[model samples]
Target: EPEVTQTPSHQVTQMGQEVILRCVPISNHLYFYWYRQILGQKVEFLVSFYNNEISEKSEIFDDQFSVERPDGSNFTLKIRSTKLEDSAMYFCASSVGTPKQYFGPGTRLTVT
Candidate 1:
């Protein structure tokens, strides 16, 4: 089976800077999601997209964050400003209309 893939496996940025994380989900999957796990915390949902629009988003996905499907095969997450608290491992996932989701190796974001 195909899998989700993320770029820049590790990212480091200064506080208040902007960053964009990229992901390429399974080609045939129609549902896409972004999740994050702080250093040792549980995986938390950030947002879900389907049919070219945001289907659901969590409070953690505040105004500073955005998701986009810039083309047929790529999905992205943009953080307008980085905060120390935002440092975490961000993961991209996809599913075929089910509860099971395939996850990508996360991109670790470190804010200083």
Candidate 2:
């Protein structure tokens, strides 16, 4: 079966550095999204991408953030500058026009 997968299951960085989180979603899925969970906080949507352009984005996705599809199979999220509060679990998900989403295990980002 197809599933979303992410790299560097865990990452630790300094507060002012940059970080790039990578993910590969199910091949047939058309919609891709990035979301984050700050330690004890609820899951928050960051952005959604489709057809090589951003389809939707939350306020949390500020100028410091960006998303790109480097190839047909890989999707990436980059944070221009990290903050202590950026520590959290980031999830990548995909869906084929369904309410249901297939999610990756997630990449844990920790900033000192």
Candidate 3:
């Protein structure tokens, strides 16, 4: 089975800096999403993209954040200016509907 891949399993950065997390979503999948877990918090949806546009987005996906399908299989999340509150595990997910999401191990962002 194919798997979603993320880079820099761990990242440490000072607050207010820019960070771009990369993901290679599953091939042949149509829906993509970004979710986060703030330490002990539940996985919360940030955004979902389909057909080249945002299908839905949660309040957590604010102006400071952006996502793109830079290429066929590459999806990227960029935080223009990170905050201390942004420290969390960012997971990239994909599904062909039915909401059967497959998540990457995640890129743990640490801000200070």
> Which pairs clash in model 3?
none
Tens digit per residue, CA lDDT, model 3, 15-78: 8899999999899888999999999999999999988888999998999999999889889999
TM-score of each: 0.98, 0.97, 0.96
Model 2 error, position 45 (Å): 0.7
Top-lDDT structure, candidate number: 1
Local lDDT at 6 for model 3: 93
- lDDT preference between candidates 2 and 3, better one: 2
Question: For model 1, what is the error of residue 65's alpha carbon versus the real structure, in angstroms, after optimal superposition?
Answer: 0.3
Could you give me the TM-score of model 2 versus the true structure?
A: 0.97
Taking the candidates one at a time, how many backbone clashes does each contain? Answer: 0, 0, 0
Q: What's the C-alpha lDDT at position 84 in model 1?
A: 98
lDDT of each: 0.97, 0.95, 0.92
User: What is the model-wide C-alpha lDDT for candidate 3?
Assistant: 0.92
